[model samples]
Structure formats: structure tokens, C-alpha cells
Target chain A: MASKTALYDQHLAMGAKVVDFGGWDMPLNYGSQIEEHNKVRTSAGMFDVSHMTIVDVTGADAAEYLRYLLANDVARLEVKGKALYSGMLNEDGKVIDDLIVYRMTDPGVSGEWFRVVVNCATREKDLRWMAEQAARFDVALTEQPELSMVAIQGPEAIVKVKSVLNESRGRLIDSLSVFQGQESEGWFIAKTGYTGEDGLEIIVPEDEVADFWRALAEAGVAPCGLGARDTLRLEAGMNLYGADMDESVSPLVSAMGWTIAWEPESRKFCGRAALEAEKAAGVTQKLVGLVMDTRGVLRGQQKVIVEGVGEGEITSGTFSPTLNVSIALARVPAGTGDQAVVDLRGKQVPVAVVRPPFVRNGKKVFS
Target chain B: MSDIRNELKYVASHEWIRDEGDGTVTIGITDHAQELLGDVVFVELPEVGSDVATGDDAGVVESVKAASDVYVPVSGEIVEVNNQLEDSPELVNSDPYGDGWFFRIKLSDASELDDLLDAEAYGELCEDES
Candidate 1:
């Protein structure tokens, strides 16, 4: 069955090229992919991310449930409207998904409530996993199907968003610090994004999302699709869960060591034992970024070889539009970041290994 | 919008062949091939004067998404190579049949054109893909 988002009609009205993405009708692109990529780089671009799954966990045990479920501690989100980025792990300490959890302020409504947003492709599995965990606890978890989501990203996103709302709300939105959120009426505005840029992800009623999308489009925001979104995120060193890591890949090797909070020994989370064991024994393979020097595009599944270790596969690879170079994220040997070679058929091509984030905020992070 | 010129023949892998009106033939990839690959970031052209059998991998074409092998439509000897793609690989995406034509060859057998598909048949073959 093909599911339709609130912006489906709007996309059709704009003559977008629609495709089925994870069972939902999505706009692959309004027209030219290169044009959309250029728009996000030079100006502003908005994506219809309503296909993503949004869930709300309420009750006193909401934070406690997240602490037990997520690899990162949600107790660090002391300030209301602050968002935390964390990875959900399986029993083997392997990352199931990476998500952003927003702690909403509810001093009067119904107590402290937190909004959890996950990838569109992993919606069902994420919800199922979350529900199973909730069944073990007393947290009230509800999927937010009533609300639609959109992400306006890039350099000119702020300017375009500000033009839609009133001066007060506009200024309030611009005043939002990174990883912060605020609710105005039924609209939830959070300064969060996957693209390495200063932007915001806004949530509102389903019907209202189309209207908001129109207003944003009219305000000069380009309607970008999954193509540009993939390139943009890859250039930012962000991982797409199913492509970069899944239930079999651990965060210790997925470049998520900093996200794990280990201070409080009392707070034992799911997969903690395995992660500790892996940490103590040492992980052989780690995720690293590759910059191809041969001018050919690097793609996923391409073989990478270190001196001693045999071979590794490219987890996620793409041409970095921002850096104007072919880059890839690969799971190579732990000590292979210094240098590596990607097999271009029978020929071995030298590739520079470095910390990812080839580009950020419209600037090339790699030279 | 590239019409299959009557002088050219095509293969299922999306390469075109030209029966050079002699005992030789010329070959290059089709426009549809480059379109599927998006912009051509790199081209690994085969060595000139090398023996290329029919359906043999002449070179590799790398795009934003994946890298694919360009197969020889007919057995031949590489007579010409388009060094133009060495710097401006986008030409393959912009003009797969023209300036982006990968290479030309002097065929071991010009009668091999009979084994290739016609323009209309090639179009039908492409349209059938999922």
C-alpha cells in the first residue's frame, strides 16, 4: 500500500516527480537534481520529512525509559525544549538506529513529555522496538501521526522561514540556539537537523504542513528531494542508519563513542555489557572517511584495503558536492585511518583517510 | 533525444557501434547509459591497440551512485580514445553519443553488427527495464 503524506497533494500540484520511498509517496525531486543540490548549497531548500516517524513518550518514567533504552543519557537534557542525539542499541551493543529526542516543556499540560523522531525507512522497526521497551516499563508512548514534519535547511533557510511568520514569532525562531526547541500554539520548532548547517525542523498539524510548505516555497525555499538530502548529509559526515550501520554494527565502531555517557555506573542501559566488553577487548574495525584522489566517484560496497588487514567495504559513499571531491564512509581496520586504498576494479587507488565531515555550513572541511 | 543514427548499431548494455563502411567498426556508450549513471565523474578507458572481444569490458564508468563496466559491443582493436573525459567527464552525461563517445575501434569482424540491436529495438529494450 502506498501511503500519502500531508504534502503529497502539494508535491503533485508543484509537478514533482513522485516515487515510493519506504511505502510512502515521496517527491524524488521537483525537477533537476543538480539544481536542487545547488539550491541547498547556495540558498535555501526544504524537504517534506513527514514520512518520518514521530513518537511522544509521556509520564514520569519517560526520561527513565529513554535512559534504559538509548545509549546516551537523556538526563543531560535538563533544559526544557532541549534536544539530545542518541543511538538505540540492540542487546549486542550494535546500533539499531540513530535518533534525536526533543524534551518538550509541559509544566502545566500533562507533565514532562519528550518527542522522539526517527528515520523514515526505520519507522516500523523503531516503533516496534520502542513499544516493546515501553511494555516493560510504565511510560506512555504514542505515535504522533496527527502532526506532520518538514525540515528547512541550508544557508538561506533562516531568512525564508522568518518571512513566513510574524515579527515576534520570527524573532523567537531566529533566537533559538542549536539543539533547542519551542512550541508556539500547536507548532513545534526545533533547531535541529541532519545536514551540517544551521537550520530548524518544524512540526505542526498535518493539514497545516502543506500550507506551511507553500508559504516556505513562495518565500524562496527550494523543494529538495532525497537525492540532495543524501548528498548533503553524507558531506556532513552524518550516517544513514541502514546504509552506515544497523543491528550488527556497534557504535564503538560507528563513530559514536562520544554519544555514549558512561559517568554514572548506576545507570546501566541496554547493550551496556556488550559495549563494555567490546571496548575492553578493543574493536578491530572503525568507520572512517575516504577522499578519492583518482577523480572517480567512490560508491558503497567498493573494497578498501589496508596494509595488513585484507579488505573492507564502503558503508556509505557519494560525491561530495560541497567539497567537489568523491568521498566515502567505510568500515576499515581500526588503525587504517592514516592511509588506505580503494580498489577501482583491479587497480588500487590511493585515498586519503581523515575524520569525516568533508563539508559543513557551506564550507569545505577537508583540504 | 538522441536518435539512433542509421549508421550505428547498439547493444543491450547501451553501447553503440558504427560499421565504418569497411572491414572495421566503431563503438561508444549510449546516451541512456550516461543518464542512468548521472554525471560521469571518471572514465577508465581501455588501452589503445588492445584486443577487445565482443562483450568484453572496455573500461569502467564511475557515476555519483555506482561504477559500471562498459562492454565492447563488437570485438575490435582500440583505434581512438577520447582523452577529453580525462578533465571534463561531465561530457559523458551531457553528450554520451557525441563528445562523450568513449572510444573507437577497428573491428576484427565488421559482420558483428548483425548481432547488435537497432535503435528502435534498443529503445524498446531500455523501456522494458524496471
Candidate 2:
């Protein structure tokens, strides 16, 4: 049996096709997956992302602990609501998970408070790792399973989400800058989303999530599912945790090098020495985006043949509903060039190797 | 319940066949199959002049989620393939029984039709799988 989120009933009520996603019975789609993907690109769409795990870290040594535990420096967060995307790596430089860490308290507050949201499938190991790391510091990790998250994304996402909030909450939402999240009236409204669109990932208590979902639906926000979320994130060039990288893949080759903060070399974060060694040894492969202008869809594990270089495998691939093209992210040899061929079921089809973010802000971005 | 046309014959593999009564049969995936494979993005059809035996791999259907192999139900030479799907594969989801038909086959043996299932038997198969 699979676990159910707080919005599971609401999902079934809305005619969602439920599937097992990382031990959670979640909605794959309400109707057409492509339509749901388009909803986020064109109008507004809401996703019940309650299956993601949220861990609140608070203590006197919170900042110092996170700075050492994560690859990115949290001390760079100048404001309370600012968010940072970082890769949590193991001692050997392998990426354990990618997450968003938010500064939950004012800069000068006595004790540091931060909120981190990790992937649902990696909940057990992530929590265990955080706990083990916190043992040396004064930080306390609290798992907030009682809260549920809903991401409303698109061009009119902010307007639709604001319409469901009170005056002060709406004002707080309006005041939020990109990649910022603020708490208001027992809710955490963040102007951050996985989709490359203006949106909010609002976290509300379990008791209030259904009503909130209903209100958003009444406001014409289409109820999207995991399928749309995956496609939207892929189009946005965001990497999925398990698909793009795992415990065995190094962050240096997973297009996550930017997430590492190497400045202030004195501050030793976890996996720093290993990453430094890997970087010094010369990175071999890098993650790149593949575009198929021909027929058929690009799928994971498909062999990408780079003409004089070497072969690579697709990490994640899907038909871009926004661009009407098949796009993929693959880890190819460092010498791979602009064009390659994919063995799409015994047929070697040519593909263009371009930077990711195939679509952004409802428009085709890559040249 | 998915649409199960009584006038058509079905295989356990979720394909529906229509005996055109002219030594040929029109074949397409059942509505249930289309519903399971949501949002078809690409459809690979068998060549118009190729001969295939029963249970041979005839084509492919790639959805947004995954790809599935389309198998032939009866041995025959491929007569016609739906070209419309190359541009608009969603037809498989929107009208699986009609415009979403995969191909037409010139039947080599009409006796193979007896092995196919009726609407009721096909419905039971779908029911048991679910």
C-alpha cells in the first residue's frame, strides 16, 4: 500500500488518475497530461506537492551547521525570505539530494532559523543525514509532515493565488521578490516554483489545504499532476533529483557545479575536499540538453552517440508540450559538441545539443 | 467504464479489430489502452506493404510517460497506415475507436478472427487487469 497525501481525496474527486510515485499515491493527471502542462505555461495550474518533505532547522548554530552540511553557503542569504538552491552531497562528492533552503528569520535574529524542502523519495536518508550532521551543532531538525504544499504556477499564477488570500496575505505575496518566501497568517507563500513561470509554492496546514485547493480551483486554476510537473520542470531546465543525479553521481558533472560555493575556501562544507579533488582531476563528463527535431520522443537511458567523442545516456527526457518538440538532458563526454545522434530504438537520429531551458516564461528561449 | 464497441473484436493486448468484410480488417488500440497511455506524443506505424504474422511487432506508440509496442493481431500484409497520427498523435486519446485507427491489414486467414475476444470478454480482461 502507498501513502496518501492530505489532498489525495481532493485529487480523486477531481478525476485524477492516481499512480504510485515514490511510495506515495499521487495524481499522475486529472485528464490530458499535455493539457495540464500547457495550463502552467499559458494560464494558471495548481499542483498538490504535499508529498515533498519539509524540514525546519532552528538553533543557535543553525547557520553554521547548514553552511557546513550543504554545498552552498547559507550565510549569503541577506534577507529572511531569501531562498537558495543547493546540492546536498556526500563525503565522496556524490550528490545525495538537491533542495531549496530558505532563511526563515531576520538576519540579526538571536537564533538562526531555516526551512529546507527535500525530495519525498529521499526523505529517510536525507533526514538521517541531517540529524547526523546536526549532532555536532546546536541545531534541531523538525519534520513538518502536518503541512501540505500546493504550487500554483503560470503567467497569471500570482493573480489567481492572490485572489484566494486575505488582504494582508495578498499584500505580503505582492511584496515577495522572485525566489523569496514569507510567512503570513499561518501560511508560507513563496514566489518560487519548479515551472519556469511566475507562481507560488504555498504551504498550508493539512486541515486548511483542501479548502485552499478548492478556492484555487474555483479561481480557474487547473489541478495539475506529477506528470505535468515533470514536463514543466524539464522544460524549465530544472533537474529531477533521482533521474538527473543520485548518490553515485558527482555534482561536478550533473550541471550542479554552480550550486557549490567555493568562495571563502576556509569554510569547509561537506564533500568540499572530494569535490575539490574531482575538480582538480579534471571533470570528464557534463550534463547537456538534447533536442530532437525529427520524429519520435527522446527517453531515458537512450544511447547518445557523440561523433568523435563517447556515448552518454539521457537522464530525463520528455515531449515538450510548450515547445512541441522532444527534449532531453544527458550526461555526455566533456568533448561532446553541438550535434549528436541518438539510438532511438535502433534508428540513429540526429539531435542538437543545446543549453537547457527549452522554454521559459511561456516562450521558446534556447536558440 | 471505457467505451467497448460491440461491433468490434478485441485482443487481450487491448487492440480492437473491425472486420471490413472485404478480406481486410481495420485495427486500433482500444479506448482503455489509450486512456492508460495518456497523451500520445508520437505513433510509429508499420509500412503499408509489409507482411506480419500474428503477435509480430507492428508499430509503436510513445506517450508522454512511456512507449509501448503495438503488436499485430492477425497475420496479413499492411494495407494502410494512419498518417494523421504522425502530426497529431492525440487522436489516439481523443478518438481511439475512429480516427485513431492504427492500420488496415489484408487478412491472410479469416479463421484467426475466432480467437479474438468479444466486447464482453475484452471488458472482463480490462477489469481483471485493473
Candidate 3:
């Protein structure tokens, strides 16, 4: 049997089609995935993101431990509640997992705390890796499995969330900046989301999550499922951990090279040497966005043929609800030109290649 | 629960056929099939002159979640395809019986229609799968 979130019953009551996702039985969609996708793009939609793994690292060496464990430098988080997206890499510079680390305390302070949220599918392996790394430092890792998360996203998301929150908590949320979070009334409210929209991801006590979800539904925030989440993230050009990059893939070729902080050369994070070697050896492949205006949808694992260049494969692909066209992320030869053909069931369909983030702020960014 | 039209003929594979009495049959996926596939985003139709054997893969219907093959229910030559689905695939979800019809086939074997299940039999098949 698969695991269930706190709101599983609510999902069933709302006519959700549940599927096994990352060992958890989660909602794929309630009815129409396109409607849910449009809800997030036009108004507001809420998702049960409780399947994500949250870990709190606290100790005298908390900051130091994160610096050594992550590909990005956490030392740059000057203010509390500031979050940084980083890749937890293996010794060979391959990404084990990509996570968001929030500075729970002031930087450079001993006995500080940092909260890390990782993908649920990689929980077991990621925990073991973190424990093994923490053995060398005076840090303690505490998994927050007792918490349930809800991500409310879109143009009107903040207002809808504010209406459902208490006045004080609402004010606290209103004062938060993008990528910032704070704990209040036993809840961690963060102004962060994966849909490239204005929203808040609230972490609530497991027992209270159902009521919160109900309140959001009553407040007119559509209860979205993982299907909408995937499409929304794809349109925003955000990468899915398992599909876009895996343990065997390096960050340099995964469109995550910017997350690697190469400054302050003395800071030797894990996979630094290997990443440096790969960079020096010249990265041969790159992840780019593909748009198909004609018929047929682009799907993952589809073969992409770039004329005069080596073959590449799609990492993540879907019919974009926002653009009304099929879009995909493919890892192609580094020097591939601005166009390629995707083999869709033996039919060669032409696609235009561009930098990712096909849509942002509910608008098409790529021409 | 999905609506099973009594006037139509269905196959175990979830396709419904309507004999137009002119040796050509109109075909579309059942309501249950569209429900399972969710919102249809794209549909690839067979060419007008292509010959298709019963149970052979004739076309495709892609939704937001995944793609599914629309199998040919009876042996025939493709006579016409729903071209509107190329630009507006949601018709399959909104009106699977009328405008959402996938293709029209000129029957090579009219006896094949007798092999299809009536509304009652198709309903039982859907129940078994559920």
C-alpha cells in the first residue's frame, strides 16, 4: 500500500483521480487538468505538497555543514528566512537531489538553524547521505514528517490566502518578500512556489491541514492536483528532479549551472573538484526549451534530431496549457542550432529551440 | 459513471461505432475512455485512404497526463477524419458522440458490426475494469 497525505480523504471526496506518485497515493486531477492548470494561471489554485520532505539542520556547524553539503553557497543568505535553491551533489558532481534551504537564523552565527526541503522520492537516499555527511560536522538533522504543506499559487493567491488566515498571520504574510519565509502560530509560511506565480507555501501541523485545505477551497482557491503542478512547473521552465535531472546527470548539463557558486574558490563543496574538471573538459550537452506549434504533443523520452549535431533526448515534455502549444525540455548537443526535429511516432516534427522558462508571471516570455 | 448510448455499438477496447447505412461508419471513443484520458490536448488521425484492420492501432489521443492509442474497432478503409480535432482536441471530452467523432470508415466487412457489444455488454465491461 502507498502512503497517504493528511488530506487524502478530502481528495477522494472532491472526485480526484488518485495515482501512485513517489510512493505516495496523491491526486493526479479532480476532473479536467486543463481547467486546473488555467486556474493557477488565471486565478488561484492550491496543491497538497505534503509529500515533500522537510529537514531541519541545527547545530554550531549548521552553516558550515550546508556549505560543504550543497553545490550553492549558503553563506550568501544574509538575512533570516531567506531561501536558496541548491543541488546536493555526489562526489562525482552528479546531483543526488535539488533542494531549497532556508536560513532560520542570522548568517555566521553559531548554533544557527537551516531548513531544507527535498523531493519526497529521494527521501531515503537523501537522508542517509545527509547523516553520513553530518558525522563529520557538529550538526543534527531532524526530519519534519509531522508537517503538511499546501502551495497556493497564482495572481490572486496571496489575497485568497490572506482572507483565510488570521489577521496577524495575514499581516505577516503580507509583509513577506519573495523567497522569504517565517514561522508564526506554529506554521511556516513561505512566499515561494514552483509555478512562477505569486503565492505562499504554508507548512501546517498534520492534524490541522485538512481544515486549512477546506478553508482554502471555501475561499475559492481551486484544489489542484499533481497533474497541474507538473504542467505549471514545466511552463515556468522549472526542472523536475527525477525527470529533468537524476543521480547520473551533472548539474552543468542540467540547466542548473547557475546554482553552483564558483566564487570564493576556497570553499570546497562536495563535487567541486569533479564539477571543475567537467567545466574544464568543456560541457558537451545543454538543456533547452522546445516549442512545437504544429500538431502532436511532445513527450519525454522522445528522440530529438538536431541537423549536423549529435542526437539528444527530451527530459520533460508536455502540452503547455498557457501557450496552447506543446513544449519540452531536451538535453541536446552543446552546439546544437536553434531548431531540431522530434521523432513523434516515426513522423519527424520540427520544433524551435530557445532558452527555458517558456512562461513566467502568467505570460509567455519566449517569442 | 459514464453514459452508454443505446443507439451506438461498442467494443471492449472502448470505441463506439455508428453505422450510417451508406456502407460508412462513424467512430469515436466512449465517454468512459475520454474520462479516463482526462482533457484531450492533441489527436493524430489516420489518413483518408489508409487501410486499418480491427484491433490495429489507427490513431492517437494525447491528454495532459499521457497518450493513448485509439484502436480501430472494425476492418475498413479510412474515408474521413475529424479535422477540427487537430486544432481543438477538447471536443473529445466535451462532445465525444457527435463533433468528437474520430473518423469515418468505409466498411470492408459489414458483418464485423454484429461482433460488437451492445450498450449493456459494454457497460458490464466498463464495470469489470473498474
The best candidate by DockQ is 2
> How far in Å is the alpha carbon of A251 misplaced in model 3?
0.3
User: Compared with the real two-chain complex, what DockQ does model 2 have?
Assistant: 0.89
Q: What is the Cα-based TM-score of model 3?
A: 0.96
**What is the iRMS for every candidate structure?**
1.9, 0.7, 1.0
Instruction: Report the CA-based lDDT of candidate 1 relative to the real structure.
Output: 0.84
- lDDT per residue (tens digit) for residues A1-367 in model 2: 8999999999999999999999999999998999999988999999999999999999999999999999999988999999999999889989999999999998859976999999999999999999998999998999999999999999999999889888999899889999999998889989899999999999999999999999999999999999999999999999999899999889889999889999998999999999999989999999999999887899999999998899999999999998888999999999998999999999999999999888899998998
| Ranking of all candidate structures by their DockQ, best first | 2, 3, 1
- DockQ for the candidate 3 complex? 0.76
- TM-score of chain A, all candidates: 0.96, 0.99, 0.99
Per-prediction DockQ scores? Answer: 0.53, 0.89, 0.76
Q: Per-residue alpha-carbon lDDT of model 3 for B1-130, expressed as tens digits?
A: 8989999999988999999999999999999999888899988899999999999998899988689999999999999999999888999999999899999999999999999999999999999999
Candidate 3 per-residue lDDT over residues A242-346, each given as its tens digit: 999999889999999999999899999999999999999999999999999997789999999999998999999999999999999999999998999999878
Q: What is the C-alpha lDDT of each candidate?
A: 0.84, 0.94, 0.94
Interface RMSD of 2: 0.7
Among all windows of 10 consecutive residues in model 1 chain A, the one with the lowest summed lDDT is A104-113
Estimate the Cα RMSD of every predicted model relative to the unseen true structure. Answer: 2.8, 1.1, 1.8
What docking tier does model 2 reach? high
Angstrom error at residue B107, model 2? 1.1
Better of 2 and 3 by TM-score: 2
Q: Is candidate 1 or candidate 3 better by DockQ?
A: 3
